[model samples]
Target: MATSTLSRWFHGNVGMVTSVIAAIAIIAIFQIINPFFLSPQGRVTLVYAMSYFLIVACGLTFVIMIGSFDFSVVSMLKLGAIICALYIDDLGLMVIPLALLACTAMGFINGLLFAKFKVPSFLATLGMSMVIEGIALYLSRGFLHIISNRAFRSIAVTFIAGLPSIFYWALAIWGVCIFIALATPFGRQIYAIGGNPTAASLCGINVVKKRIYVFMLSGFLSGLAGILYMAQFGGGSIEMGADMSIPLFASVIAGGTSLAGGTGGPQRTILGVILITWTQAGMSMNAIGHDIQLVVFALIAIGMSILTANRKTMSIVK
Candidate 1:
């Protein structure tokens, strides 16, 4: 009986246990390689670097948890930043709301294409990403749009107790997501749909509606990340978010969220974001090449997949 109980406990908590262990091992290795890797300044820099990505990761977590992929997140980020920059001069603070609405609409369209038209999520998001990228490029004429608003800039740069203001923004967003994912009925429904859509639908869950909501939330958060990115960089560029999907996906998966879905949440994503961000920061500190960093990220994704694979549960691995 004791052995059986132990087995059940380990099975229930294996994801969290493994993720925490991996994070600690990586940190220890980095710290050994570079003594300054854990310095106060290094930690602060790591947090700042991860702030925007965390926001994006939080949203992506939901989409992934639904057993769907969203490749348009980078495009949404770029589009949101572009939209905000284009109108900030005329609309002032109103640009923030306008940009978010535009992003949400883009997400809604993705949902419509996937849920209503029966287009595959992967293809729908990929096509939408291309279209959005084209729109951003056309609007900017393939040039950077620099933002000069002090108020907007301060949102990213301002420090509170020695931490970037954007960190707080990310934390708040992450906190809300955790609440929604764990405490709300909507959250439970998401897991149910992801676990078995047929079963969920038969049980009276609105699979289509929830899937749409997931994409919309993903878009909204991606837009939020874009706005923050513009604030931090003081500009918007067509290529700003081109390569974000890799790290964002890595963070979600590394944090213990199963690629197969039906398990994991914002809490797991938080740890994953920290691990990936720390890895990136460590590489920078150690003067590792960008190409090598990309390789490391790829490995991290592959490692997480191997670690989390459950042949019994993963019916269709994407």
Candidate 2:
């Protein structure tokens, strides 16, 4: 009975337990290696790295839990920021909403294609990603568009308690995501679909509609991250939001969310974001090469995917 109880407890709490342990381990290792890791400046930089990361991961957590994928996250981010940078002078604050609307629309299409038309989620989002990137490039003409809007920049850079406003924004959104995942009926349906779509449908859940909403949520969050990125950096360009696929996906998986789906939450992704971002921060402090960092991220992503996957749900290749 004791063995069974322990097994049950571990199975239920594995994600939280592992995430906390991993987060602590990363902090300790980094602090020891870099004496300045806990310095005020380092802390600020770490917060900046993790904050937007958490923002992007919020939507992804829901998507993963709902058994879908959105590869267009970074692209949407770039596009949204580009839209903002191009028109912030003309549209002022209105451009922010405009940019978000554009991203949300893209997400809606992603949902319609996959949920309504049976496009593979991966292929659907990947193609959408290319389309969004092309739009962003055409709009910006591959030029870096810098914004001089103090008010807009202040949205992300305003320091509170030694951290930027973006930190609080990310934290608040994460809390909302947790509530949505654990409290709302919609959130429960997401898990239901992720766990077993056919069973969920038989139980009266509208799987198709919910899947589309999930994609839309992912798009909104990704776009929000892009807006914040623009504000924080005072600019938008092709240079920003490039090659972040590994870090973003790896952060979600590293937080103990199963790649096979139905088993992770934003609550866990926060820790995962901190772990991956801080590790990147630490490695950058140590003068690690970008190529090496990519390798490290890829390995971590692959390893975590193996560890957290629900093998029973995966089909045999043969």
Best TM-score among the predictions, by candidate number: 2
TM-scores across all candidates?
0.95, 0.96
Model 2 lDDT tens row, 1-318? 999999998886675577678779888988998889999999999999988879999898888887777899999999889999999999998899999999999999999989999888989999999999999999999998999999999999999988999999999999999999999999999988888888999999999999999999999999999999999989868879777989989999888777677888887888789878888999999999888988988987887787687888854310
Give the worst 10-residue stretch by lDDT in candidate 2: 309-318
Instruction: Residues 63-130, candidate 1: write the lDDT tens digits.
Output: 88988889999899998899888888999978999889989999999998888888888899999999
The Cα local distance difference test for each model comes to 0.88, 0.88
lDDT for 24 in candidate 2 is 94
lDDT of 1 at 300: 83
In model 2, residue pairs whose N, Cα or C atoms come closer than 3 Å (at least 3 residues apart or on different chains), thus clashing, are none
- Candidate 1: give the clashing pairs: none
